[model samples]
Target: VLRNLAHNQRNHTSLIQAGAVEPLVAIMRNSWDAAPRINAAVAVACLVGHEEGNPRLQLDETLVDEILDVLDAACQGTMRHGSFWTVWKLCQGLASLTVNDKNKELITEKGGVNILNEVLHDSHYNNEAAHRYALSAIWNLAFNAASRLVILKTPGLVDSIRDIVHKSESIRTKEAAKGALWTLGLEQDVKSLSETMAQDAGWY
Candidate 1:
């Protein structure tokens, strides 16, 4: 219900105005039910994605940690067969959280870069949406110095990303790969990176 409501930016603003962020955070913080927690997480992710000043001031590291735990569970296939959408949702959540400076550091501190990198590497054969989400998450994390260092430190991650950039035939995957590499400072200097999306390919 809440996730659908937050699908539109204007509706998300209205929901935020109606004090939705607090309860959504509470749900993610307290609910043991995966469905409720993921739903609330999507909603809060929308709020934090708002184009305003420091929207993440309303959030904290605990939220990113919680999202990562669920993401790891999804990657581990512990969530009702571990659907691709679930993994994508969690990765998307982490990507959004990286917009916050503190959350970016926390993501590396919490081992999120490796988690996303693992997804990127392992999903290369599957060509799932989660594959792209993992790439996007890695791209986002590369914006932070600490997180970028951790991503660079992750074995095979750089090779995987570089490989995707030159080998991926899918435009979506190739562009996302380029974005990740560009942010990681491996690609030749370029203008702003697009938040590329594709249902196929993986590298980080």
Candidate 2:
């Protein structure tokens, strides 16, 4: 099953080489069943990045954009039969894709930041997983300067993330929320919180 494969990092290449990507995309785009759609998204997330420095998923620019588009559409509920779990899985895939630098830039250009921010405002799915992975996706996007500034400007987004940090019971979600806040709090400046502490300690 895709979920089992997702748990094992070693199977990533084997699955992709077997042409699992296209089918997975198809499921994410058109699966009438929410379970298949959600599983497909998680499988795609597992194939996302590796130590090779080239994304297993970002090999094609158009494919990357298409995935982002699916995610955006799914968030908006235009994609058929999408459930809260499906949206969460889609966010998980988006977060994983942001592991690649090029994907980060592409996602920003495709309005993925605004899309993720809207998840916080949408009342349709107050699902915890969706909120967590949305924060995680934004956390990854915050690594880029442009994305960070855009995130700051998005209405109520920063506050919504902070709310999650204080209220979420999931430690993973809280960590991601904190990570996004920390990254955005830099104000386009260099020095991280740890870096600032080290500098003050005269560690150089």
Candidate 3:
């Protein structure tokens, strides 16, 4: 019953906005099954939405930790593809909520920054779908001024974004990287790097 409510395509994502995420996450904690857990993560991601600003949905207080835990669990196994997709969705949703100092601080405290950087740097993360979504998440995070500043101050984000941009074949992925480069470079004081991108991509 609960599973179907979550898994059914007919199930409206709008429910989460009505404040349904807490119970669903509660169910996930007891399911002990990967499929249901994955669904829960997806649902929370759905609740988060993909826009650049904060959405109309409201997450439960534990929402962030629950999503992070699910993502953390997903990364410790052979289900990298599935886990990545789930995390990708999760990031898209969370990105919208992380526009403030407190949320950005919470995300870093939860280890999100390091995990995302790892995904961007991983050799196996080159496929178009994976690369596109993962890079998009990275770009979104970089769009947050505080987060972008933190990322630039992280010691390797510039090189990481540069490597991903030049190495990736997916136009979506490259464009995502370009967006991040544009945001961080210009809005965050990396304009020299942005000019470099303009030169390379012939954007004159």
For 1-204, candidate 1 gives per-residue lDDT tens digits of 776677556786689888888888788768876667666867777666644255533344665566677777767666542433356666655656566677677778988887887777665334555666677778877888878888888999988877766556677776777788888887552232221222232322
* TM-score, every prediction: 0.71, 0.66, 0.59
Task: Report the candidate with higher TM-score, 1 versus 3.
Answer: 1
Looking at model 1, which ten-residue stretch has the lowest summed lDDT? Answer: 190-199
Evaluated with lDDT, which candidate comes out highest? 2
Q: How displaced is residue 145 in candidate 3, in Å?
A: 3.1
Query: How high is the lDDT of residue 6 in model 1?
Result: 71
lDDT of 1 at 64: 57
Instruction: For candidate 2, give the lDDT.
Output: 0.70
Candidate 3 residue spans exceeding 4 A from truth: 1-38, 51-61, 78-105, 123-126, 186-204
Q: Residue 138 of model 3: what lDDT?
A: 58
In model 2, the worst 10-residue window by lDDT is: 186-195
